[model samples]
Target: MSSPDRCPVVHFDHHSPEHAADPVGAYRKLRAEHPVAWTEAHGGYWVLSDYESVFEAARDDYTFSSARTSYGGEGLSVTIPKTPMHLHIPIEIDPPDFRKYRKLVNLITAPAAVERMLDMISHYTTWFIDRVIEAGEADFAEIIGVPSIVTIDWLGLPVEEWSRYSSAHRATLSAVADSPEFRQAVEVDLPYLSKQMWEVIAERRLNPADDVISFLVQQQVDDRPLTDEEVFAIVDLLISGGVGTTASLVGQTLVWLYQNPDVRLRIKDDPGLLDRAIEEFLRYFSPTQALARTVTKDVEFRGCPMRTGDRVLLAWGSANRDEAGGFENPDALDIDRWPNRHTAFGVGLHRCAGSHLGRAMARSLIGQILERMPDYEIDLDGLVPYARQGVNIGFHKIPARFTPGPRRLPRDDRSG
Candidate 1:
């Protein structure tokens, strides 16, 4: 057992160029040598790379808090190098109050509710594909427009502004905080989004609609109704969640399928195998890589002294690939891996409420591609990956070519 002051230390920076270059290789090294090592980056924190350590820490919310700032109290944010942004309700708030916000969000995003949107998800996916099918080649990263439209439509925001949101978010997540791209997103794009959201929120207050905005405006917390700030925060969180990660997974999976024609052929021949394949992809190429939690008290965790307010990064990507976690040939992408308990959507009370929706959307987007562009070939040399993979691993551009095809349905047809 290592003493509090004599624990293993490593100079690991998740946002560094080295990490972005080869994330899995970097994490694999950490898991093998120092699963629970201390790092001096981002004002210092512990990186939990092993499956058991991350799983246990995530479930023990009381000890490892997610609060950006405790409800009505002073605390640290979830991110190691906390971003200057609105509170991500439910995720950045601990239980009790966390449940209140989570429950409200869940009311609309539950599995059954997402099931209701499968056709809609498929419709948008097909529509996006239609735009590119005739061209014979496309920048596949533009598939993000599907989720952007779906998310804004769900929130009752103007769907035409989907590209703005998608591009801004992609920029924000792909760059380090100090980078010019990140600055542009934070200073320019986010403010515009907030303004637009506020306007819609005001409109929803007077004339409610059958959408999330109206639903949120009428909800109450504790004995009183939620304020405008609270409403904005929740809505912002939803947009952030809805727009980015699923699309990242889709992009990564597309690249993987292009490289593995055998797996692609199998999935195309039997659509039933897709869900399992998506699971394996999720485990293998975790989009949302690591999320941070603040230690609540002084204690020894995984044989290291964790003082109060110390940031601990739970490396979900590493955990999924942990061989000791019972994942045989952990580095390989096994589409048939059953009972796969990967933490891609995280674990415990703070597990993503939109997991069902994300999975369904991935299904529709990727399934449509396999069906429509069965012989598509990626331009690997032209691929442009994200400059940073600290929080998410994704591509900025995935250029590909396939045989041209006719549109399956009219653009304006909801039932198409």
Candidate 2:
């Protein structure tokens, strides 16, 4: 019968350098001692550290609504200090209406549709690797980041401006809470990006094509085509969702493989194990660490009372390591670990639509690296992590040196 006034309180900052350096370790400690501790940071929010709590909360979206409006009706605030942004399409919307927007985007991001992009993913990966294969040394982030944006470019959006979009998109992800950089990106970069999307949307309206933008422009919701604002919101969702995270996964996993040569050797020796390895890496080091959900109604969860509109952070990284959550040796990285129901891509209605695309990109990038740079070794001393780490955990720089190789793909093979 613990009440909100009596529950244990902890001083935990997800963006702190200590947590950024090793979030798993932080979660391991929290889950053991204070599985549902209340934190004072970002205006006081409950942090669910154990798998059961996070999983249950995520499943019961009604109780813990994903609506960003729960905060102040400003926009989809997934973080504390609430970044000044607009609605992020389906993610910021609740069920019923949420499904409408999701259905439209899902047409392209579905597993079958994503599978069709494998060839293009391979081509993009080859294009990126070709740029660095001969240099012997390269920043893995740059190598992976550009191609990821380009892949999304092919999905719809102007390919000519992939670099600009990629830079702004990455900046938006890595920006700190209310920092100058974050403010600039939110105020400047996001609007600019949205305007670019609007241009594409306008173009698609006049001349439809076999791309996401065209589909969005023509897709009807409840017997009517989506409005301009709706189209822009969907584009915002897709662009933000498409970039950054996959690149983070590829870059982070490459660093992990380099650190653990035995695991690297095993994967290199048996390429069939790559899929499992990717899953294991995802569980071990979740890129999208935590997401915020607003309480829909007052309720008691695990002896703690929650009021409506209260914000809670679903620690996906912590849940992945929760032993009681069906994972054995939760801390250990077992590429072959079966029945691994990790929440790396989250769960319930709001599960990531671009998950399949993300996996394809990761697999493609990893395969390309292993094939072309089998002996690539990361400069451990040069590795740098992103400054802010609440939502996304990734490396800013991962410099590696490998035996030089010849380019296999032609430069003109850019378009899939």
As for model 2, its CA RMSD to the true structure in angstroms is 2.4
Give every collision pair in model 1: 68-77
**Model 1 agreement with the true structure over 1-416: per-residue lDDT tens digits:** 22347268886999899999988999999998999998877667889999999999999999998877542134226655776667778788888788888889899899888988888788889888988899999999996578878888888888888888877766766677667888888899889988999999999999999889999999998978877788888888888877889999999999999999999999999999998988898999889999888888999987888888777899999999998778999999999998798999998998888888888989898888999999999999999988888887898899999999989888566422
Predictions: Cα RMSD each:
2.9, 2.4
Clashing pairs in 2: none
Kindly give the number of clashing pairs for every candidate: 1, 0
Model 2, 1-416: lDDT tens digits are 22357367887888777887778888888998989877777677889999999989998978988776747336556655455656688888888798988888788888899877777777777877888888899999789865555555655877766766766666766777577867767778778867877787898899999887787788899898899889887777777777888888888899988888898888888889999878888888887899888888889999887777777889998999988978899888898998788999998998898888888888888987987899999998998888987788888889899999998877566644
**C-alpha lDDT of all candidate models, in order:** 0.85, 0.81
Off by over 4 Å in 1: 1-6, 70-76, 411-416
